[model samples]
Target: MEKNFTIASLEFCLSQLKRADESVVRKAITSGDGLSESSDDVGQKLSEAHKNAVKQCLTNADKLATLHNQIDACDKVFERLQNMLCSFQNNLGTIGEDMKQLQVQSLDIHQELENRQKVRNELSQFVDDIVVPQPMITTIMDADPNERGFIEALHELHHKINLISSRGNGEAVAVNDTIPILENLKYKAIEKVREWLLLKIYQFRKPLSNYQIFQHQLLKCRFFYEFVLNHEPAIARELQDEYIDTISKMFFTYFKAYASRLFKLTMKDAASKEDSVGAIDTAKSSGISGFFAAKPQVRNRATVFSIGQRNGVLQSDFLGALIVPHAAAQNNQSFQFETLFRSLQLAFVDHYSHEYLFITDFFLVSENEALEIHSKAMARAVSVLLKCCEEQIVVNWDAISLHLCICLCDKFQQLLIEREVPDVNGYWETMSNILWTRFDQVMTNHNDSVRMIDLKKLQNQGALDARPHFIVRRYAELTSAHLTIAKSNGKEIGPKVGALLESSEDAIEQLLTRMSTMQTSHKNKHVFLINNYDLILGVIDDNESKQSRIYAIVHELEQKSIDDFVEVVLDPHIGFLIKFVTECEGLINQGHTQLLVRYNDKISTVITTFNQKWKQSIDAIHSEVMNLFTNFRLGTSILQTIFTKFVQYVQRFSKIIAHEVFSSNSACSEMINVHQIMLEIKKYKPVY
Candidate 1:
């Protein structure tokens, strides 16, 4: 019962005691015989235990009350927390609704901003595209055309007008309203440009005015023409017509005066009828007395095709000198026909090339329009120059000079092409036509001159002699010159050249026949014919292309003449020898051995006569040939041919002498042999 066993242990002891029966306790007490330490001690222990048990129960009850009070306070605290959590959940729900509403408001605000931005952009574009600034209008109305601001302003106005015209609609009423203002400004600008351009163009009409400078100035503002053309085509047409008229008239007057003054400086001694190839001076008397008459002493005349002396006419320095009045006067010189033609053409080419470029650049026209404009501008000047050329070509009898003029025209045309000048209007083509026409006419004139030659007049004038006729030499030179020109120009002059050659050949044949009539004998006639033909051949021998048709023809004629002359001259030297050989061969061929035997007696005689006289015959023939033939080579050639014929004749006769029919005569076998004859002919040949 001490400190180790408190009220709860006491209660445990009392509960155990109570659980014991009272009868057991009484019995145990009454049966003292079995009882140990008495019932009194047991009672006291139970009593103390019971008091302790009760005190513990009262303390346990107070502790239970305190635990119950603490449990109720926790219940109150948990209830208050639960109410606060409910309030928080309700606030959270409210906030979720508020956030959804704010999100919607923000999206609406952003959508509003995007719509406002689109509207602002559309407004800005409309304003920029349709607005025409006051500064631009002022520039178009009053600004100087030379100022850069004016062109810029005009460009802006044109753009705005184009935009309005292209996009005019119900929504673009503002843009359409600007059309009148832009049109007024456009007209004003065009008027200003037109006045300025017309002033510059009018200045070209002034004498000694620097039109090139003005043209250069106009080129800077060439865009003005394009603008006017686009806005008002009628006004553009007027300007173009005015420019063409003014410039064309100026060129006409300028070229007309220049050509007139230039024509005076042409050489007065140009080729004439007298210088013609077939010209004959009928006034002169024939000085010849016989067929072998000496050729008249001819003056030293310039060769027909020798144009080197006339090259000064094509010199650039000479062209420049002739253009200047002072220089031309100081030189006091006359130019050839080609020089005059070249100068005038060169001037035209320069003017044309410059004017063509200027018109195309300044007008901004198409190529066809530019060409038309150029043709109109140059029409008057071209007509005058071409007329002058035609008249000069008609009168001038120098075909060589005319040919040179044609070459000059071709060269100038090439130069124009190189300068990129278009020939759509046929200016060069027309010029070439005129030149070729005149050239062919001149050629025809020459041909006609040859065809119309008077043989009687030529013979009476002593123009025909041992030498080649002047006409033949001139014809050869002209043919050669024409061939050279054809080759150089890459043109086909064959038909014309052939006609000329045929005419000349006919004339030469006629002339030779007439001269042959004057010969006293057949041999002399052949000699005269041979001499003239040989001379003609020699004249054309220097031609590089020996394949020329004329060369072949003349060569053939010469050969025929030589053959005739050789037969005529050689027949006398060995006529009987050839006849004897022929007669014996005929008798042998006819199977007449007896007749061949009879001819053998005449064979030695014929051989002896030929041997004794062949040298004298050769010497006489040589002397005659040297005296008659003008070409010494031809004379020697003839002599050699005669000597060869003489040898052949003697060899034939010697062979006839050695024939079996004449073998009975020992003297025939011992006669001079062909070897001895060759030895004798060797002495006559020239050493060279």
Candidate 2:
């Protein structure tokens, strides 16, 4: 607009100037100014001024014409700006409409999410209430106001459900019950919806992940743990196995997803550099490699066997492998060993620790469970805690589980003895006998004096060292506890006690003679003399010759160095474990001094290792310890009761032992209250 105005003003001014110039010319001519004589100079000056004025007017007009043309170009710019303003206004209106639609969509999505969550929550409660119960039975239980033993009620409900389903009306009607039956129905419905969502997610994820039906298997595992295994632990081992099988299969699916995601990222990165092998190498370096590399060593899914025989052997092997390495390693290098020990330790927990946790729950679980208390009143609660490795996120790869085995073994074994739990290990007699023979060997070893043999000379002389023998002696001075004769009301007997108690004299004699006769050509065989607990060993001069028969003996039995893990191995270093198991068997068979102290010695040995090198076994007291060792087992919540009792037992026993051992005066008190000791232990409960 400004440019247009300026141009118009310029044109007007120039036109006025042209008119004025013309008037000047007319005045000059019309006023009759002479072109001759004295006026000739004035006429010539007028003509020149006229020409100059004409030129000035023409220049002004020409410039005005150019300015008008520039003004025309300004119109184009003005039109473009007007169109831009209109487009911006239109876009703003569209955006406003879009915002309203988005708000509506957001509200709808929120409502949908709320509905689903409500369904999931209500159903979860319903499902929890009747997790092990049937619907009809739950109704019957609920029919009564008393809320006890919903277990049976649940069973009854299941039967009813079966009956209804059998009649082909499975989906027809809802059966309400005492224990949140309608809520349970909604719970199931919510489950259906969740399943649908999960399926959708699966569909979306499948092409990218190649993962199939894995979550379903996880659900099945959850079921087996919650329902079948929780109810019956004899089957727990078997069911857990099935769960692990499913887990292993599912892990592969998870691996594929993880592997593919990682690979795609790497491949994309490498595409610019054209490095395909680099991508593959990166994939292999991830967690999937560890899994695959360990695959070749995977046994046909290890299962639980009796711990009595097998544990001793395994302990021996592990100790043998560990001791030398442990002794040589630097203090800070413990973490490396911890990593190596993790798999075995976990394996130990999976087998033994959990079983004991379930069975001994009475002594383990706390009464005032804070989680339960807080959750009871609130509208919502975070049900349990992160207790085990599976539950935790930042699990250290070097977390050695061996300590878990040690923890369970120590408490449970001592508890069994203190409580006089009978026949716990199942091979009490056999184990006692084995224990006795080792003890006998130890006793004999202490008493005998034998000269050392020369292994070097025998070998160099081109003669197979013919012999070395473990000596045995018969002592008739031992009267073997014969009973005195006694009389009953009407009858007299030769002896009051039964004669079945007599030792097999012939067998004992022959055994001693045979052991004594098998002497080696070399003088000393590290002869061990025995007399009850008294031990006296013969110090041999040639130490290397003393164990000449060790290789042959161990080889024949396949007993040393190599692992015999079916019943478990007896590593040469902890070969004393063989003696331990043997002595335990011997003691049980003979009913010698109640239980085997020899086996107890073995336990003490393990304890010594633990005390000395606990840090070497990386499993630490968990950073966030919930209920102390409450999550003793990872399998299930099935054994909550027995485990609770065990905790109580340990508390009591430790206090009593401490009191007796530490105070000379307190030791005199006999027949004191075990419960009293427990009460004292209650004082030690952590303030957490």
Query: Which 10-residue window in model 1 sums to the lowest lDDT?
Result: 313-322
The 10-residue segment with the lowest total lDDT in model 2? 480-489
lDDT of candidate 1 over 1-688, digit per residue (tens)? 5766688877985686688798976686687754346546777898999999988988799888899999999999999999999999999999999999999999999999999999999889778878878999888888898899988887787677777677765566786677777888888888998997898899999997777898898888787887888888999999999999999899998888788878788876677656666665433335455445455444333544445445444344323533754468579978777777777887888888899999999888889988889999999988888777777777777777777676666677677788999853666677777777876776666666766777677767776556556676676676566555544554555565566566657766775776677766888777777776776666655544356677688778878887788777777877777778788878878988886766756766776777677668767777877888777788888778767776776677776676777778766654556676667667767777
Off by over 4 Å in 1: 1-129, 133-135, 147-149, 152-157, 169-174, 209-213, 281-326, 406-464, 541-545, 577-606, 613-623, 630-688
Best lDDT among the predictions, by candidate number: 1
Cα lDDT of model 2 by residue, 143-250, tens digit? 331233433443444444444444453332342332355335434433332343334334523443432354333342233233333233544444333433433333
Instruction: Return the TM-score for candidate 2, rounded to 2 decimals.
Output: 0.18
Cα lDDT, all candidates: 0.74, 0.33
